[model samples]
Target chain A: MIKQLFRSCIFLLVLNAALSSCSNNGVVKESSTADKMGRFPEKGDMIMLTDRPPQLETPLNIFQQDITPNDYFFVRWHLSQILTKIDIDTFRLYIGGAVDKPIAISMKDLKSKYPADSVIALAICSGNSRSTFSPRVPSGQWGNGAMGNAKWKGVKLKTILEAAGIKKGAIEVTFQGMDKGPLPDIPVFVKSLSIDHALDGEVLIAYEMNGQDIPMLNGYPLKLVVPGWYATYWVGSLNTIKVLTDTFKGFWMTKAYQVVNNAEANESPDSPAKVTVPVSHIKLNSIFILPEPHQPVAYGQPCHVEGLAFNDGTGIKKVEVSVDSGKNWMETTLNPEISKYSWRRWKYEWVPKTIGINHLMVRATDNNGFTQTSKQWNRGGYAKGFIEQLDVKVK
Target chain B: MLKKTQFIFIATLCCLFLVLHSCTQQKQPDIAKPADENPNTFTVKGSVREIFINHDEPDFPEAEGKEIFTSTCTMCHTLRYISIQPNFPHKTWEAEVNKMITKFHAPIDSVRAGKIVNYLVTIKGVKQ
Candidate 1:
């Protein structure tokens, strides 16, 4: 009996040490934490960049479908103290500041009192592909998964503000959410838009996403969906709307998320641009979906190459693919547009002739005749609108 | 009597195996279940259930001032923020640490802040 007990103790210790080493060895990869897959509540396994102010990126394969599911939607929040629990019954969206008759509307009131509006729009992070930028910037080093397309259901911002009776001198509209900073001096996360953009019927205060209540992590009760703009403006767990007569200069707007005042928002590292403006409007970009990086393709087999092309609500005129290192270009068939603001899917049938590695590139042209440029760089790594290239090996 | 002792020993070994497996699986930080729910699982509330993210800190390389770096930086965010960043110049790391102190009001003293910057520069700094 004594001999048996000693043997069992030795066996258990060995097992424990082996398992601990396995987990420790897994962290040997560069950026192991970023590469580590995590499953948050109500979310699928995603690339977790941080956990405190949860920043989760959707897997790239989820974008193959036209509509990104709410469970796999990308999440990005700025403030550290996020809303974990809430009493939806007592929640009220307060509308005041530069209004003749300020009013507080409940969730029930928001749905019943105002007309319901729905739109299928794409909300992309301003720094979505910041990792891919050459001379990499030191922000959220995300790939092309920091964006998602969803069917947002809510009342129009115009309708909500008009119901509040906007004063005559209202110049800009500011939005605030329940999220707060850790320190009192740390500025509360807020964003502003011009009065004209706020009153635009397209801007929505979404309560439901993809046919259900927005996930708590994605912003439970309310989310401001600024269609055609970067997701930075789409505040989550939104509670307050203020109409300011003067220009609203907040830390988020005037200081952070500012890009160069140019078409591509490009700048040099040695000499940064002096003038900068708040980042808005998704830039023209396209990404290859099929034949994922390093995926093998059979020689002489007609592979169905697929991708997505999108701009700032401007309809895509065409998406061209180059299989021969941009020496030749072929136009791909664009699927029917879901909405003016939704991403347009494009497909191409290509037969690989070469047996070695073949470089594939994709670029999009919008209705305004603006074709994606081959090179772009910025200090903040915002607005990755350059041409995308993917390489695949043919067996 | 010998058979009974053997049976008890086997039972204890099985329980040890189970406990060891669970210990390896629990790499993520412990999070409490929602109110009035099972300890092991989350309550399914329609399609959009509440979510709790995993806060597993990465194993950073050991160096001088690593303790200060980990404690000061993680006061607001996970060390993954630093793990995900590509190698930057010393000036960039200095600016980043100073920004935390000045802009975001991180309560790191100047001397410790310099030490933290030195640690970051040692691990992930590149020449401009």
Candidate 2:
């Protein structure tokens, strides 16, 4: 009996080591302890802003791929209590309020009942490059990694609402996710869309992202995909949809995510814009993918510069790159459009003449003939579509 | 003799499983709480797995109002939010504090809000 027990102890130790190593496999932690807050499960090494309600930013290099992988997608949540676990068997998306009939649809029903639809869209945060804003901003302090393009597949919100029989008086529809706040007074993260926009057939209740189930941090089970609009309206872990007759004056719509009601969404710090509206369609913007910040380019050699240009699916008319600040602009070759809502990749071939630091900039012009402004500022640091410049050293 | 041997084999299997499972469990931090609060089992029911984040608190410089800053601000988010921010003017930091209280409805009294702003400006402040 003693000999058998000793053998069991040895077996247990070996088993423990194997299981522990397996769990730690592929766990990549950033070298700088100060920059890396924590590594969440089901995600690669992300720039973790906050842990409680994770605000993770994807590394910039991950944008090289047109379709952002589910594992490397950026995550942003407002409330502290985010849903960590979900049961698809019991989960029900309740549609109620100004509808003729309230219906509770299960995950299985949602996938099987509705005609499945998919759209390649770019879901970007309104304050994506908030850290790069001049004079700086207090929130998130995110680099250009808070956006991702993915093929979202699921049912359309219009199909669900129509089946539920929308009442005539319904003017607006409110969406609420499973996330909640620590305090009852702290308003839940609720966003509203006009009844017309909700039924546009473009808005989707996404179940699969990039051909697979979305990572939990990126909103598993269900996520609202509002193409061409800022991601603030993309409610994650979505469970409730309510139609209302009156305009929804939720805090998220009115108090937060509001930008100046101007062409450029610009406002002076000294004289902040009095008139503000909820941020809607994304603005024209482009970002460099190659020769990362401070990454050197070969002098007297043809260097290939690549980047992504995206806007509110307005269709990119052209993308231009300037090697010497904004003195001269060369039109970049845009790759074939994947979809109207997806970001278009652009590339430029440049031969560096100077051997020292050179300023490289990129700007995008949309189908509406709107070019990105060189300098744009807003107090909220929202809707950052200003021209982006990267200083590359030539050796 | 056959029954005793069978019992020992089953007991050994149980022991090995328990030891392996315990080794794979994620280590929880003192400040951060996993969504599944059950200490006995970190596993959640259904297809989705429970997410665990190892939140190591950021170090803050010793200054006045550090206590009030850490206590009041950390109620909603971690200190990395502040750590990631570039130095802003006192006015900017003050506005941020007020925005948190007024806009987000963070339960911070005026006195506490002032101290928190002072602490942020003291460490992460700039003359702008």
Candidate 3:
């Protein structure tokens, strides 16, 4: 709602200030979101960042279960024109180009052809915590709720590629969905993955999320699930799968959703790094489950300070919690996981002795040895896996 | 070493940052949050056929030049895009206005665009 209001604000000012700036068409070098209005509704406890094509985010506590509820799952669609209803009887999945033989398989044929395979994985937008960027980024000023973990049930993408018969020289596989933008000038939402990545067993064409036909906003008929990768690569409302012979250069892939092509995938807003790359596997991060910021904890009482930590499927090795503004640190206990790709739930016990504002923080290290940082800032507002700090008032 | 006024300015800025950038807004207890379903089999229920998102009207509905803004600028997108952001300064608003006109090819002519920018700077932008 606030975004629309900004859209209509007449051009009322002339460029007049001398502020530090980024090179993105002379936009000032701040990544902070200018959030005047609060959350808009996306459905079932989820808040929408944008309304037209419906981009939604889950609340922090929605992480109550490692497996997010299907009804509350967040939805994101780049295109404005989405097919609300599908004629399942006539729906066909067309697999064409760079294959031994082009094939169009119906929903029924897909179900009967391959046994359903399932995996629990997180689908995260690359800009999950974009709003928290200090200087403020221009769009999608979202908090961390832009991600969700779910048990997705579908056939492995490898199954379909195998049935199509591998033809040599195929380099990538492209996917298109049933949604489109308002104008033809706006590019179609198409994304392509490397052929090797496509054939990887981790990729799935999920028709069901958390034991139900995927919600309409969450992609009704199908979604391409790339475990550990950002949701941009996870094509929603999947329709066509086209194999390619060369590296894919689609706008969604080549242009948008890229991070600084560096080891840390981070760069400065004032001076951007050269050579950007598509934002790939998520970085390690943790969040507070209990004692939410400003939530009151009883003084001199036992309290469970808890939250979830996750990586791009690499297991969380250790989680450390600090209650006195990182003055004293304690190791948190992590619950045994049901799925490797899912987040690990962690908890720490705190007995607050004093009554005041108590800062609680949690940091995690993944098996990959990537430790969470105190602050993570990127130019396009992406991949912030900083240690989460919450201020709890112990009364 | 910063001057006293400079310290206050920076401190105010920091406080503002904390207020605007804090993760998770005030909790709403009444929102009905659903629980996770069994991660196994499935049965179809009701479906979402279509969505017509009802956006809120602009905050400055009664402000000057609101008519020109709604008539011209609401063509491509709703007003939510602008309203959702933090308070932008005059220059940022100018750049943003110019961006929409030059980059996005928004149909607002220079005169109207200038008026819109003026209104934004006067009402929504940082006070000089």
Candidate 4:
């Protein structure tokens, strides 16, 4: 009888252990969905979300509010797989190049020395319109959600440069990120900027994005936030800082990231021009998020035509919505609380009076009087400002 | 003796109940077929044909392409971006590939570019 009791206890223990293992196995299987979607950073995986389209369906009108939640912010990384951990204390920012004093400032010092300032600026991809090009550009074929508005909290770039004492003859200020990955034989990923632009009070070495510490995918410890500049100028995992006495040349600065004018007279492999200098400010662009692609909407019903708009740094002067192609247009009311660097939300209440396919178009103009047009196109597919027109079947 | 037997009997019964409960709770390997499952798996005759007609060739030899794509293509986007696009003519495809080298700074070249474009056009391109 005693032996039987002992055997019974052992059996129960074994059963419990088996059940626990099975449950763990089930969890492992479920977690693979994100991995399969390529969201998980693995050995040999590039850290940039640019490595693939985001798993979430991109929301139209990315500028609905001032603060873009970390999860929703469109991610762009040049190199390094997703950073899982960042230690802020030990992290140091190196500021050098044509400076009276090249200095390395720790995270703690950066906060203590300068009065913290926040700015709202649009960070857009230079190749945001790669898909619309005659020959589809090969990159993340982002359908308009690649840009977002976030209120960045940090000390101004000029504040840091002034402390270091900007020297004369500094043609360009190059920034290198701590972000590292296997680049064939190369060991690092870096980008640079002109000294004039670096001294702009708006250029920031930001510690916080949208009122919080930036998430790992969005450059956690620190990142350069060049307001109104394309993301290529915004270097992540920034580690090396150099002041170039001559023109800065690297894979990113020179051979790659240039807008080669195949049609221009001087267009050649050796003489390609970098698209880094801010060209035309961000042209007016908007997207309809509520009625998603191919979703049905009822005819003769009140529908909210909602989206976001921005005029780069100039600020939006006006936004217009057209329900009948471009034949008719109406002014859209802007959301007042939107951040300056973030996108401005706009809405026009529309009742589709007719029952056919309604082509809806949206356009905007900045304070500088630069209006949105459908004719802009570049070889690299940069700055595609064509009006967003959505086709919906009205029942 | 009788008391001991009863105790043993109760303990055995409890153990049996636990064993049965655990077996029942074990997640059965999904018996239901997912809506998108394709049951028919077959080997393709050749790489080009498989890519062209079946639209099912790995972008590169599984080992080489995956590494190159991860290093180069992923600098800016995921593999699905390539997989999701409707295939285009070679000329249009070349222009698209060059845009990465030129605009977004993707680290691909004529040789790798040719391989990637061939694989995409064969497998992912919309049939003309």
Q: Which candidate is the best by lDDT?
A: 1
Candidate 2 residues lying further than 4 Å off, grouped into runs, are: A1-34, B1-48
- Ranking of predictions according to TM-score: 1, 2, 3, 4
lDDT of 1 by residue, A1-395 (tens): 77877888788878877877765555545434434666676777788787778899998889898999998999898877887667777889999999988999999899999999999999999999999999888889889999999999999999999999999999999999999887788888999999999998999999999999888889888999999999999999999999999999888999899999999888988799999999999999999889777789999999999999998998899999999999999999999999999999999999999999999999999999999988899999999999998998999
Tens digits of per-residue lDDT for model 1 on B1-128?
56887888878877987888787768734333222342212234543334454466767999999999998888788887898898999999999999888877789899999999999999999987
lDDT of 2 at B119: 94
Top-scoring candidate (TM-score): 1
Candidate 3 lDDT over residue span A1-395, tens digit each: 33433332221111111111111222221222222212322246466465555667777787877788876777777666876656676788889888998898887788888988999998888888788777776667788788899999998999998888878999899999998766556668889899999998889999888888777778768899999888888888898999888888877887678788764566776787878888988778888868665678899999988888888888898999988888877899999986878888898888998789877888898887777777667767888787777888889
Candidates sorted by lDDT, best first: 1, 2, 3, 4
Error of 2 at A14 (Å): 34
First chain of candidate 4, TM-score: 0.79
TM-score of chain A of 1: 0.93
User: What CA root-mean-square deviation does each model show from the true structure?
Assistant: 5.1, 9.2, 16.3, 11.9
CAPRI quality band, candidate 4: incorrect
lDDT of 2 by residue, A1-395 (tens): 76876687677778777876765543433334334634566676677777767898989899889999887889999888888777778899999999999999998999999999999999999999998888676788888999999999999999999999999999999999999997778889999999999999999999999888877888877999999999999999999999999999999999888889998888887798888999999988999998777788889999989999999988999999999989999999999998999999999989999999999999999999999989888988998989999999999
Q: Scored by Cα lDDT, where does model 1 land?
A: 0.88
lDDT, candidate 4, A301-386, per-residue tens:
88877877765566887789888889988998887735566677788888887787989888988777767775545445666676
Residue-level lDDT of model 4, residues B20-109, one tens digit each, is 766765645432122234231222332211101011111333533455554566555445456545456676666777766665555677
lDDT of each: 0.88, 0.86, 0.73, 0.62
